[model samples]
Structure formats: C-alpha cells, structure tokens
Target: MFTNYHEAIEWIHSRLAFGVKPGLERMKWLMNRLGNPEQSIKAVHVAGTNGKGSTIAFTRSVLQEAGYSVGTFTSPFILTFNERISVNGAPIEDEEWLSLVNEIKPFVDELDQTELGAATEFEIITACAFAYFAHVHQVDFVLLETGLGGRLDSTNIAVPILTAITSIGHDHMAILGDTLEQIAAEKAGIIKEGIPMITAVHQPEALAVIQNTAKEKNAECISLHDTCSFDEQQPTETGERFTLRTSKRQYPQLETGLIGTHQRQNASLAVLLIEWLEQEGYISVTEEQIYEGIRQAVWAGRFEKVKDHPPVYLDGAHNEEGIDRLIETVQAHFFSKKVHICFSALKDKPYKKMIQKLEAVSSSIHFVSFDFPRAESAEKLYVCSHLDAKSYDDDPRTVLEFIQKKSDDPSAVILVTGSLYFISDIRNRMIG
Candidate 1:
C-alpha cells in the first residue's frame, strides 16, 4: 500500500509506460472489483475534440451557482494532476487522493495478472474518480470528460444522465481515425440508449453521425445549430457578450469570462444542458443562476491573460482548429498590438499547418520544445514556419526570457500557445 501522496502519485503515473489499450473490458473488470462505484453516481458524459473542458467548466459553474455540488473529471489537466478529479473546481485534498489510491492499488495489481492485463494510467485515474464520487463523497452531478475517443475511453464506464458533444474536429487521428466521419463515429459512441444528447457540432459529416447515433439509440438529440440563435454577439475585453435565444428561453446579454467566439458556443452548450436538466425535472436552477455562473466561469490556459502590464497571454491551441480559434481571439482582442508568439506542440500533431495559421497573425514567432515524450523539437517546429521573424530554442525558459525582453514595448502583446502540456509548464513558472 502506498503510504504517502508522493508515492501514490508516482505509482499512478508509473502506469503510463503500459500505454493506451482502447477497450472497456479492463475498465469493466476494475469497476466490478471496486463494487461498481460508477453505477452509484449521476454523471454527464462529455465527448469532443477541443471544447469539452470549456463546456464542462461552464456547466459545473452553473450547477454550483444553483447550489449543487458538482464533480468534474477531465484530462490533460492545465494545472495539477489532482485537478483531473475535482469537486466544484477545488482539487480533492491530498488525504482524499491517498485514500483513493490505497483503495484501488490492490485491484490495479490484481488486474495486472489477469487476461485483460494491467489497466492504463487513465483507467486507474478514472476508477479513482468514480470511487471518490460514489463511495467516498457524493455530489449532485459528475461531469465525465473522455480522455480520448469516447467509445473506448475509460470514462465511458459511467452511465450519465445527460451527454454532450462540444465539437468534432481533427484530433487524436491516429487512434480515432483520419476522416471527420470516422472521428465523429468514435465521439458519437458516448450516446446511450434513451439518454438525451446535446451537441454543438456544426460539420455536416460529424453532425450526421451524431444524429444517426442518437436516432439509433432512440434518444432525442438537441443540436445547438437548430436550438440556439445569437443576437448582438460581440467580443469583450475580458471575454464575450451576446443575446442567446434558445427554443425555450431568451438570455439577454449573456456574458462569459472565457475568451473567443468558440467559447460562446461552449457556454451555449452548458446553458442548453442545464436548461434541459431543469426542464426534465432533474434539477431546479433559475436563469439568473446560469447567467451568473457563466459570468464567473474561467478555464486556465485558454487565452488567459497572466499579466496586465505589457500584456502576456497563454492559450493551449495545440491543433489546427484550436489554432484557428486562437488566431481569431488574438485578432479580436489584440489586433492593434504587435503580437509575439511562443509556440510548442506534440510531435504527432500537424504543427506545420498550425504554425502556418499562427504565422498570419504573429509579429514574430519563437518555438521551444518542453520535456514530454511526444513533444516536437524546437528546431523542427521552427523549420515548419516560413516566417523570417522566427527563432528556436531547446529550453522554454530561454525562449520566455527572450519574449519578456521583447514585451517592453507598450504596444506589444506576448502570447504563449501550442501544446497544453507546454502551457502547463509555462503557467507554473509565470504564475506559480
């Protein structure tokens, strides 16, 4: 048994070497051994390529505003590992994490000897989250964000009361498939029989897949494209403001702390889900609660302004679609300022295409690779850029210092983008 948090965390992370095996058999066995803790909790299964975390943040904040304690399970945490399983935005205490790891470590060891083999790192973490929410401390609702493609993801073990697909895009293509249709099929796999779904997917191929899946499951799928109508939508200095009209209600001047136009779509998904919950008699939440919740919702590392003077922002736009959104956000907010970019990405991503997009908006681009197995090297990312005003560095700190020196101009704005892992590292150094 692990006696300390450090040992417990180390053991949990050690399972990473086993790599990802996409199947539910191991998760089913683990859950069964743990008394099926997932079955005891009311969950909302969320799947998508990019906006899942933002959607969950908006939803959780709204639920909390209505006086409900919400548990959220998300991946690739922007802050700490403990943020993966948090209650009302607070990471579970160290003592709670230790207890959870102790309770599940035996099953993890036992599973290693079985036909299904040892569970992956994500599976163990998913189990810990389920056990904590169900057996240790219950909450009004648990939001489960799939770590990868939905169908085979470990978080799929939970039978959620509601499900949402934030958006379908090209991400995790190696495991999920290359085409939008194939990716959509994997994402739509979260749709359960008779469980209503909500989505913000606009792509025809992707939307069709989700619609067909919902129809096959005999579930009503609510598409934001069909249900939501925006009026007077405009970007704000801090975030955004818009009048959102859904089939059921009209929210005047809805505001959010999250940046970009895509965030508006994300916030809309949360509003729709919360409205659906209230309409279905599962929860009671006033409209005011939702508005306040949205206004208060903030997800770190998504165009987050860490410093005011000589403004410096961080955005985790690792993929092409994410980079597009990041570009739009930068254009919308800092069009007048000279934008200097610090970028890094995973080796497997289409950094060439993403860097191409960022090049259009950047005054100068600096590339630096961080310490991750899959991370692309600074030289490789730098070579991908066609910009004459670009530089490369092996150490991110050196690149950061160089960018800080350039940020002396009052008209210059510094942006750190690309991989979330890289952003997490930079955020700790800059803020913590």
Candidate 2:
C-alpha cells in the first residue's frame, strides 16, 4: 500500500514501461475481478484524434448545470495525476486516490499471477476512475475519453449509454492505422448495439466508416450536418460564439470559453450529446443549462494564455491536425502581433508537417525539449528545419524568459506548443 499521494502517482507512472497494449482483454479481466465498477454508473464514451478532452470538459460542465453529478476521465494531465480523473471540476483528492489504489492493487497482483498480460498504466488508471466514480462518488454520468484509439483503449471497457466521436484525424497511425477510414473504424469501436452515437466528423472517408459501423451495430448515429446545422458567427479573444439549429431546439447563440474554431465543433457535439440525453429521458437537461455549461467551461494548456506583458500562450497541439488548428488559432488572434513559437514534439509525431504549417504565422521558432522518453530533442529538430526563423533550446523556460526580456512591444506573442507533455511541464512551472 502506498503511504503518500506522490508515491502512489510515481508508482502508477512507473508502469508506463508496459506501454499501450492493444485489445481490452486485460482491462475486462481486471474490471471483472473488481466487481465491474463501470457497470455501476451511466457512461458516455468519447473518442477521436483531437478535441476529445475539450468535448469531455464541455459535457461535464453541462451535466453539472443540469443538476447531475458528472465524472470525467481524460488523458495527459495538465497539472497533476488527480486531474486525469475529476468530478464536478475537482481533481480526485490524494487521500481518496491512495485508498482506491490500495483497493485495486490486490486485483492487479492477482492478475500478474495469471497468463493474461499485466495491466497497462492507462488500464489501472481507468479502473481507479471507475471505482472512484461509481462506488465512491456515485456520479450520475461518467464521460470517458479514450486514452488512445477507441477500439482497444482501456476506457473502452465501459458499456456507455451514448458514444461520441469528435473528429477523425491522423493520430496514433502506427496503432490505429494510417488512413482516415482505418482510424475511423478504431474510433467507431466505442459504439455498441442499440446505443445512440453522435459525431462531428466531416471527413468523407471517416464518416463513411463510422456510418457503416453504426448501421451494422443498429446504433442510431447522428451527424452534425444532418441533425443540427451550425455556423460560426464570430471568434472572440476569450472564446467563440456560434449559432446552432437542431430539429427540436434552436440555439441562436452558443458560447464557449475554449479557443479555436475547431472548439465550436467540439462544443456543438457536447450540446448534441446533452440534447440526446434529455430527449431519451436519460438525464433531464435544458438548453439554458447547456448554454451556461458551454460558457463556463475552461480547458487548460490549449491556446491558454497564462501570462501577459509580451504575452505567453500554451497549446498542446501534438498531432499534425492539432498543430494546424494551433497555427490557425494563433494566426486568427495574433496575426497583427509579432509571433514567436516555442515548440517541441514527441519523436513519433509528424513534427515536419506541424512545422510547415507554422511558417505562415510565426516570425521565429524556438525548439525546446521537455522531459519525456519519446521527446524529440531541440538539436535534432533544429537540424531538420528549413525555416529561416528556426532555433533550438534545451531548457524550454529559458526561451519563454528570453521572449519576455527581449520583447519591448506588448503586441509580441510567445506561443509554446507541439506536445501536451511539453505543455504539462510548462504549466507546472508557471503555476509554481
């Protein structure tokens, strides 16, 4: 049994060596032994290449406003391990977390004796979240975010009432597959028989895959294009205000604190999910409640401005599509200002493509490496770049400090992005 919170977290993170094992057999066995805590609560499974976290955040907030306790599970924590599993916007308490770990450790030890492979880090975390939410907190709804691909992610062990695919893009290609259709199939794996699924995927190939899967499973899949027509009225510095028109409801105005036009799509997906939850009598929710939830939602480290006076912003745009949105959002808001980017990426990421996209908005690029096994070094990243504005830094904070010290103009914008892991390091430093 772990004596302290930090020790518990360190022990859990130490299991990263097991890596991501495809398939849910280990997860299923673990859950079965633990009395199936997932079955104790109504769940909504969310999967996609991007926007999954933001969508989870939006859904959680709205459910709280609708007078129901909501439990959220999302990956790549911005601050602490507790943030990965939260209820009503509060991270799991260290005491409670240690207790859960102590309870589950016996099951994990038992599994190690069997022929079944050891549970991965994410699997244990998933179990912890399920046990905490269902048995301890007793949340009304659990919104689950797939850690990796939907098909075999640890979180996929849940039989959700509803499922959502925010968007299908090229991410985890080695595991999920290289093409859009293949990735979509992996994402669509969360859909179950007779369940109602919602999606904001617009890619023709990806949409076809999801539609076909939904058809086969008898899941009533709703697309944003078919069910609710939406148009972005405008983008704001704080967030975005959009217009959404659904079959039963007309929200002339919808607002969210999350940045980027892509966020409107994620928020809209959350609205649709809430609407379905209400219509199906699963959870009673009003449009006003949904609007309020969207308005108050705050997701950290994605184009999040944590400082001013030579403005510093952080975005966790690890994949190509995510980096594209990061560039777009930066250009949309900071085009008038002189922009400098402090970028880092995991070795597996398509940093070349992400860098290519940044050429349009950035005046200079400072490549910085974070502390991660797979993190791409600044020296290597600098060598590959053809951009005239490229440089490298071993210590990421030095780049931020340099930007602040050198920039006399208040309009100068400094963006630190590329990897969520990098943003995690940056955020902890800023908060301290």
Q: Which candidate is the best by lDDT?
A: 1
Candidate 1, residue 169: lDDT: 88
- Candidate 1 local Cα displacement, residue 365, angstroms: 0.4
lDDT of model number 2:
0.86
Error of 1 at 46 (Å): 0.4
Write down the TM-score for model 2. Answer: 0.97
Cα-based lDDT for every prediction: 0.92, 0.86
Task: List pairs with backbone clashes in candidate 2.
Answer: none
TM-score of 1: 0.99
| Candidate maximizing TM-score | 1
Model 2 alpha-carbon miss at residue 15, Å: 1.2
Candidate 1 has its poorest 10 consecutive residues by lDDT at 399-408
User: Cα deviation of 30 in candidate 2 (Å)?
Assistant: 1.0
Please provide, for model 1 over 251-322, each residue's C-alpha lDDT reduced to its tens digit, 9 standing for 90 to 100: 999999898889999999999999999998889998899999999998999889998766888899978899
